[model samples]
Target: MPSESFVASRLTSGNRLFPTVVEVTDSAVIRRRRTLFSRSEESIHLQRIASVRIETGLIWSDLIIESTGGSDPITSHGHHKADAVRIRDLVTAAQTAHLPAATEAGPSRACPFCAETIKLTARVCRFCNREV
Candidate 1:
């Protein structure tokens, strides 16, 4: 049973030990960065996602995926804005699809404020920070 996966480009040469990349799997979201002699990866399980926030800048964007069970969030920085947005959409879709039936209100609807897809019952738009 193959699953869905999203990975960023890792071919940017000439950047020293900071060969960082973003990965999103059916089960988790991952951020990996490597240095001269060390490499680190942060992962956030899809089922544990409590909230996701993205901060967009002119040149780069930051992604933060907070967990529901009190674990540290998986954060990735300096990614292209498009990539950050894509990550958020993927994670949100996965969460909505995997959530327990008891917690699901119904099919999700588009947020009127920002037009970004969000849960049908959501009162706040995560992308535009507006009332839904």
Candidate 2:
């Protein structure tokens, strides 16, 4: 079985279509070239498929194909999708955490000239103080 991450990477890395020479069986070899076309006009060549196999199982049959192309594109897409999901979850969790509650428990500081709240470590009021 192909790795999900590897397959996902290959599927989305801007190379939607892959082309290659395929050896379907021990004696039959065919060159398969797949191109992903945007608007059916602009086409981007993906990879050169070199081989294909039909594996029969107890329930169903599966087609296993292979290509002799660089793994960069596939790996890139997989990494990108995975990274995006991770980042999104991290942001959501951080937002839901007790941010204000933690800050409220610390010492309170205020600007002498204005009623604006400030940080204790601040040398001067960020909103109004001109000199330290």
Best by TM-score: 1
TM-score per candidate: 0.63, 0.28
Model 2: what TM-score? 0.28
Query: Per-residue lDDT for 47-119 in model 2, tens only?
Result: 2333333444343223343445632211112223333343223333433442355545466577777757777
lDDT of model 2 at position 44 = 13
Instruction: Report how far residue 92 has shifted in candidate 1, in Å.
Output: 0.8
What's the CA error at residue 13 for candidate 1, in Å?
Answer: 14
Q: How far in Å is the alpha carbon of 126 misplaced in model 2?
A: 0.9
* CA lDDT, every model vs. true structure: 0.73, 0.36
